[model samples]
Target chain A: MQVSVKYFASLRELMGEASSVIDIEENISVSELWQSILESKKVVFDNVMMAVNMEYVKSEHQLKSGDEVAFFPPVTGG
Target chain B: MLIEIRKEAFNAYAEMQYYLDELDIDGQYGATASFVGTMRDFNEDKNITSLTLEYYPGMTEKHLETIVNGAIEKWNLLDVLILHRVGKIKIAEDIVLVATWSAHRKDAFESCRVIMEQLKSGAPFWKKEETTTGVKWVEKNTPGF
Candidate 1:
């Protein structure tokens, strides 16, 4: 299964790419996918907000094929 | 209700007037409360030139709609408007405008404030500042108490 991963704001700068697609095992949790990605790049972000298909979700949320996942820092808009 | 995310700056008063005039409320609203946020020249004690705002496109509009609809239901508001700027914005320029209309001042005032507070904390917009030294992303927002 493949899912599209997106990074925004500071995360985008650190990731060096706005978005990418990765193949993953079925029913992987959001945190597991993030850990795998970060470990490969030697980067760490302790306070990340996660979203699946544009809706905010917990780290333990399960992923599915064709999901649009987003990771970003805490919001700072007015 | 009207929700807008624009790359250009806008006048809060004019936007509010235009939106309110178009509504067919038939003099149903007795109070209108609004809040306008502007860019400041300094942050973290450093002088700043301008800032760029980034968002998640479709997700941003959805989140804002949820916030506005929640406020309207919670306070029974008659009308609401929210406008936020994106891309580069100079210091002292308007960054956002939130206005609410209700039958009384209490509902209008409270709903307007609640919407702003929720938007500040929950919205997916990110701000990157151009300071005197260099550019940096804002990690957190000021407490909305």
Candidate 2:
């Protein structure tokens, strides 16, 4: 399966790209997908938030084909 | 309800007038409560020069709509409007506007406050503060209700 990943705000600055599409194995959780992309255990996953298809989701949420996964920092807008 | 995310600045009075003119209130609404959030010159003991707001294109609107709907369900509101700015904003410029109209002052006031509070922590928008020294992403300290 394949999914589109998006980075926003500070995460976008750190990632250097707004969005990208990547192939992934079927039924992988959001955490696994993120780990696979960054290949880093140093990242504090608890500090970040994830959204699937524009709705908030847990890191353990399962992903499906063509899902749009977004990772961003906590909101600070009013 | 009106929800917009724009790069250009807007006149709050004009927008309110337009909304009132278009809606058939028929003297049903007794009060209108509004809140405007502006860019400040200082934050966290830093001399802030400007702020750049970024949002998730599709998700931001959805979250805002959900918030407005929740407020309507919780209160006896006749109308609601939310306008947020994106891109670079200078100090003292309007960054967000939230307004609510209801037949009673209590409902209008409570709904307005709830909407603003929800928008602050629930919406998928981020603020980058530019100080005299450099730019930094603001850390979220306030918890969402």
Candidate 3:
């Protein structure tokens, strides 16, 4: 399965890129995907928010092929 | 209801006037409550020179619509308008505008407040601040209203 990952705000700076497409095994959860991605970065998972297909989802949410996943810091807009 | 996310600067008074004259909800609405959020010169004790806002284009609009609908469902609202700026924004410039119209003052006031609060925490917009020190992404804890 291919998942499109997006980083925003501080996460984009930390990731050094805006978005990427990664190949993953079937039935992987969002948390598992993050754990793999975070291994190469210096970022922590604290206070982070995630969304699948633009809707807020929990870490335990299951992923499917061609899903758009986004991660960002807490929102600060009014 | 109107929801717009754009980079162009807007005049709140002019926008409101145009909306009022065009929508003509004055006959049904006795009160209109509005809130405007502007970029501040300072944040976290640092002097902010400019601010840049980003969003998930399609999703941001969808979430805003959901919030507006929620407010309308909870209150007896005649109309609502939400305008948010994206991309580069300077200090003292308008960042967001939320307005609600209702037959009574209480409904308009409460719905306006709820929409702003929900938009702050629920919307998919992110802001980066440029200060004398450097550019930093603001870290915000969701506030309970």
lDDT of each: 0.93, 0.88, 0.88
Q: How far in Å is the alpha carbon of A46 misplaced in model 3?
A: 2.1
Can you rank all candidates by DockQ, best first? 1, 2, 3
lDDT per residue (tens digit) for residues B20-139 in model 2? 889898689999999988889988899999999999999999999999999989999999989999999988888889989999999999999989998997899899999999999997
- lDDT by residue (tens digit), candidate 3, B1-145: 9999978888776787788888966579899999998888987789999999988888889899999999888999999999999999988889999999899999999999989999998898888889998998878834656
Q: What share of the true interface contacts does candidate 1 keep?
A: 0.88
Ranking by TM-score: 1, 3, 2
lDDT of 1: 0.93
The alpha-carbon lDDT assigned to residue A37 of candidate 2 equals 71
User: What is the alpha-carbon lDDT of model 3 when measured against the actual structure?
Assistant: 0.88
**Model 1 steric clash pairs:** none
Expressed as tens digits, the lDDT of each residue in B82-111 for candidate 1 is 999999999888999999999999999999
The per-prediction CA RMSD against the true structure, in angstroms, equals 0.8, 1.9, 1.6
Residue A22, candidate 1: C-alpha displacement in angstroms: 0.5
Stretches off by above 4 angstroms in model 2 are A40-46, B141-145
Q: Write down the TM-score of every candidate.
A: 0.98, 0.93, 0.94
